[model samples]
Target: MNRVITVRELIEVGGFDETAVLAGETFLEKELLGVTSFDSPDGHKWLRPGEFVLTTGFPFLTHKESSESGLIKLIDDLVEVGTPGLAIKLGRYIESLPPKVITHALNRQMPILSFPMEKAWSDVIVPVVRYINDKQRMELVQTHAIYERFHRHLTSGDPVSNLIPLLHDVLQSPISIHVPTLKWNWETPPAMRKDETIVYVDKQIGQHAPRWMLNQPLARMTNGLFVRWLLHDQKVQGAILLRQPDRDLYAWEKVAIEQSAALLSLEMERQRTVSETYQRFRNDFLQLLVSGKYGSRHMLIRKAEEVGWELAEHYIAVVISVKPHSSPDVETWKENLTLLETIRRILSMCDLPILFGLDQHNRILLLMPATENDESAAKGILTDLMTTLALQWQHPVYLGIGRLHHSWEGIVQSYHEAQISFRSATHAIGLANAPLLHMKDFNELGLERILFADKPGAEAHALAEEYLGKIAQYDKEKNGQLLYTLQIFLQVNGNYVEAANLLFVHKNTIKYRLQLIRDLTGLHPENGQDQLMLRIAMTVHSFGYQA
Candidate 1:
């Protein structure tokens, strides 16, 4: 199963009359792929990793002053570039190797090989090239056989599950394929799991998934072949795993895995399209049911059954939203899909009887049977999900969970609560306290929900103006920043240090402004009541004002 050709094999192919390893004899086992001649100092560029170089020692030997130094530098360059070994055709341009050069090569463990005096550069390069080509030809035949074996199954339009057997055949090992996102049962999509196959993640990459147990079969597992389903922008859709636990992988085996991955990508891409369509239908269906548009209870049950939901008589509704911002439309879509898939996998792995779907509003809707600690369970799910997502998205994505509903039909009310909670969180952006809410914990908004329930009326605006009209007028007249400073100070709970940060000013500047506010408004912020009054006035002014 060894695919790597070694230096000794190539020397045997060259049929050198006499050969000796001057240094690094142990390192002669280095794997070599091809060979080329190096007559100049910069000829290293033509050589690649795992290649042997044939040289006349021209550039090094021609320099009599520092021939040893030149050879030393050449050896360093060869080792740095990953050239396996060097074969010098002796008694040509170079008379003999310097003792220091031999020691240097030994220290570096770089194989310094010598060719018979009769062998020219052509003799070495030709045989090595032919040897590499012969190996490649044999590899091609083996790789072809593997490809054809899988190509037949691919051509037959077999389900992705068929890949397991084909890979088992190619590698002569047991194989398993795990698609983390593939879940649920739907007749139209044959690939969809009938048992709702769960993909578990306590934060592990695809390669790290646990191996299934097979008794007394495997000694060691090989690295998997990951056929990544990537979008045009290089966003991965998912991966198909191929593993053989019985033996170490050869280069040809890896190549075959790559081929199977390609086939799997095409197959999965087609399934993705079909799945997306079905998901859209599911989304529309859930939106209708949750929006309370069902004509009868039977109709609701029927539609729910169509999407494979085993709904309980009583249900609790939850909504998860991704706060939107400026991102490319395509990028946003992909992220949402990826997030939904992950959530689905996690829920399925937990074996929770949850019916979930994505709506057009960038929200995930869920219906679960009401339980004793359903709220606590929901909180735990969001806690782990948000932590995982913060790492997954590499950006701060927020979510809001509505209060549990008494009945499934109460989704409309619960969803609205989630929206309000989400609003309360997002509205606090740029403030000292960020909006990171989950699972009915939107208590952070306390009374602002009522105070700023609607856009400020004329009366509220007039009241705000009366409280700080002098400061506003002064700002307008002199283009001063008293009002701006006041707003930041109030938002930071009258903390001068925090207010200074918002204004990008020193604490002295904030103090001077606070004194000015006291002199101008006659409302001393030093008083806790006055601070509260000022905060209320500011909230009234900014009511329904969005950035």
Candidate 2:
């Protein structure tokens, strides 16, 4: 909304002629606050520098009152104050410009122009003001057009498919949208890529991109202005970023982008709510089936129908268990949720219907349709699933399978088999290379023997009494060195050199400790039975014998 006017424009419009004269000759085209007339004897003191000063040099320099020398001295003082130009009213003040003032003005290059006293200064100011006002109106119209296009797309109910195109059209630039997959890491996108298109919704936005699209020459140009929004309803499992090149977005464009992002985020949250509700229904249905609450075909069929299932097809069940090997504290419910989601995604890729349940025990049960394709493909699929889970989660996982059954009425049979396989895979003492089992291959009574042979509290109590007695004796004798030595020896498997290096002591010092252990406990670590007992005692002491 800024307007700069030139001196030539001002002169032509003001209708001034070239009769009035003085010496100095430069034109000052800067903005002026007000215009007024002044006399030379006032000595340019009332006026500041760099302003357009109007005068006729009349009253003070008239021939009867003042001499030419006094007038010339006044003009000299005015130039010293930085007056770059002067406009004079001629024929009313002096007959002509003083000779000395004219000479000095020419030498200083300060322009002096004359105007007929008949014209007013109003002729100069009005036109420039009107031009600036018109320019501002045009800028506002352009801003509103861009804002309207972005707002319309945001409210259209399909922001991912609609908003990017509207923005690209308005800005005249190509745009890309990416959504990330919850099952995989950020480097992979959940959905397929759509390029140079106007319509599409990605199932996974940021899963993967072409190498050319991500590397330099492209990413550097596009990613700098990318905007990201987290879909809060999805538990922060995914995000979306919008990218464009060539055009720099203005402040109004930034506002539009954020508003559209917020709308998309809300929609994603609504979808997640629906997904979670469906999952809860599936969990309740499976729990009822496994617990034998719905025993008859009629009862199971009615329940499945209520939950929106077709209810007449055969069902195959698979159970997956994630074991915590390092520490119980390391287990997380969110991680289990992610694992269930991944299994569901993989199963869906095969176009199968799967109902899954996850429990606090870190176990998942997937009840899928028992079509020929699924039954024939189950073994390879489950093996690949186990390997994928191990690689992705960086932990070992065990899976168990059950036989195919026809209809919801036979789900209990499959459930029993899956439970037995889960038990056998997890608890069988020395079984190696055991495939995921079917109901007939496993025996309920045999699993009972393996599962309940040792009560949890009995082993804990025995280890506690043995390890606690040694700790008490060591504490009373004021000899913590023996406990420290025993811990290090067991840690190194009785290697004298490694244990000594760990303790930063001579190798003989560790040998002396082993001798001292025999003196104290009357057990030699060189004996296999004694070594096993001591190792168990040390492990029990470290975890707290009380627990």
Candidate 3:
């Protein structure tokens, strides 16, 4: 409704014709931009579209050779140029109207009215102009009112779902917002975006920031269209899907959708900012807790409580590291925000107090309440999370789980165990012909659970490092195969031929390397006690751990 005054309203306000005598009456609802008056014969030549012309019949009276026909041509010309209507002050220069002009104006739906000879342009022009300007002002007020309502809803922390009903009220059309990226909180789009819409949207998303039609029904929905991209600076956050079931949208409807998208963009940006801030806070807190920096359980509990975390006495830790598939459009190294929400949504049903964070290496660290009896429940939750993430996103994700621990400091212990288990699983999965010790194989991870687990007197067991440390230093200095030869030799239980087969070398070469290993250290290969010590050192070295 925020537009120029219509021709019908203009006539009523001006009282331009007492009997309402109109040559063309079909298009009274046509909008008029302004009013102009002229007495020249060629006045239509200088007229602008939407200008309602007022004239005394001088043009027709002066040109006597082509009076009726020329007037009819002028009437047709005005209609073609979108002049809504014309007002002729008759009875002075011309006696009565020409029938041809009236017939031509009527055909084109151009309203042509005749006023009295005594009336000046001022009598009608001022009143009509005042009415148009007043309507224009009123339209501005309505537009501001609409904008303010949307602004209040956006700033009031209402969810994006709440805006759908608001748009319904504004547009008077059934509308839905389809954002595939953030579907966790929103309803699924009326029609699932098929391969057609998906491919098109994917190709253009974050590229075009505008309202557009998909040119057809997206999927199940029929007869409604237009997708407005929700963008902040070139990045597409989501989209708004407008539905007008019976017909295409009007100009004002399009305007309302665009304005609503603006408010939606703000909501998306604010949420992004808040999510980032919260994730960062959680990240710092998790790091501090796992770093063992706090002096006591009381210190940790107080800090955890500050963030509304109810830290249970017994807790289990989980760590995940994900690497997204390579895409030319994305940065492969950055931690994906999608991973955060995916984890949140997947585990939301577990009925446990969950606290989680993301680490610098694109790792996720989560602590969940656990007890002796919750083993099956914990595994079920983990299995659900792992399966959902893998199936939904199809990324290379590694999950490391730790055994339940009873104390606050045990939380740090659980974290280290989980990280070590993760790295160990990764290393094992990479070995040629080795059975994979995957995170999902919790039942078979008995040895892995103790591989890097905390135990008393780690320094005492570190004595094995003295043996391998010399061999490691020699290999570093000479790039020799002595360290590897010693490890293989012990692994094969001092068998020259078996070690040679495993190393893909001649038995003589293996013997030769064993002699060199003997020269480097006094522990000869054939001695049982010395071989046992060397095997211990090899095992510790292979773990990539000194203690």
Cand. 3 TM to true fold: 0.48
In the range 175-290, model 2's lDDT, one tens digit per residue, is: 44443332221211223244432112233232233344333111122334443434332333333344455344444445555555565566556666787788778778788876
- In candidate 3, what are the lDDT values of residues 1-547, reduced to their tens digit? 3347777888788875656656767578787888998878777788888899888767666444337876787787787777888887766666677777677778888887777677778888898888877766766676677778777886798876777778878776556575544452232334444435444554444333444333322223333455666655544545666655544444445556777776666666776688678778778788887777877778877878766677776667777665421223334335445566656644543444778877545577788667653656766766666665554444556567766666667777677667756655554452232222146332334334445444523522443564567777888889888888877787777898998999899999988877877786667777876676576566666666542
Q: What's the best-to-worst order under TM-score?
A: 1, 3, 2
lDDT of 1 by residue, 1-547 (tens): 3546777777687775444677787776678777777688899977788878888787886544438888999999999999888878677777678899999999988887777777777777787787777878887889788877877887788877766667766766434454445541212123323221113212332222233311211123223322222221233333434333433456677776667667766766777788778778789887886677778888887887786666675555555655543233666667666667767666655677766777656566666555543666655665665565454444445454555666666676556555555555555553233334333343343344334333435434544675578888877888889888988887787899889988899999999988988887667676775676677668777775321
Task: Give each prediction's root-mean-square deviation over alpha carbons.
Answer: 15.6, 19.1, 12.9
Candidate 3 colliding pairs, count: 0
Backbone clash numbers for all candidates listed: 0, 20, 0
Worst 10 residues of 1 by lDDT: 213-222
Worst 10 residues of 2 by lDDT: 181-190
Best by lDDT: 3
Worst lDDT 10-window in candidate 3: 429-438
Assess the local accuracy of residue 98 in candidate 1 as a C-alpha lDDT between 0 and 100: 85
lDDT (C-alpha, whole model) for all candidates: 0.64, 0.55, 0.65
Cα lDDT of model 3 overall?
A: 0.65
Pairs of residues at least 3 apart in sequence or in different chains that clash in candidate 1:
none
TM-scores of the models, in the given order? 0.61, 0.43, 0.48
Q: Best candidate, TM-score-wise?
A: 1
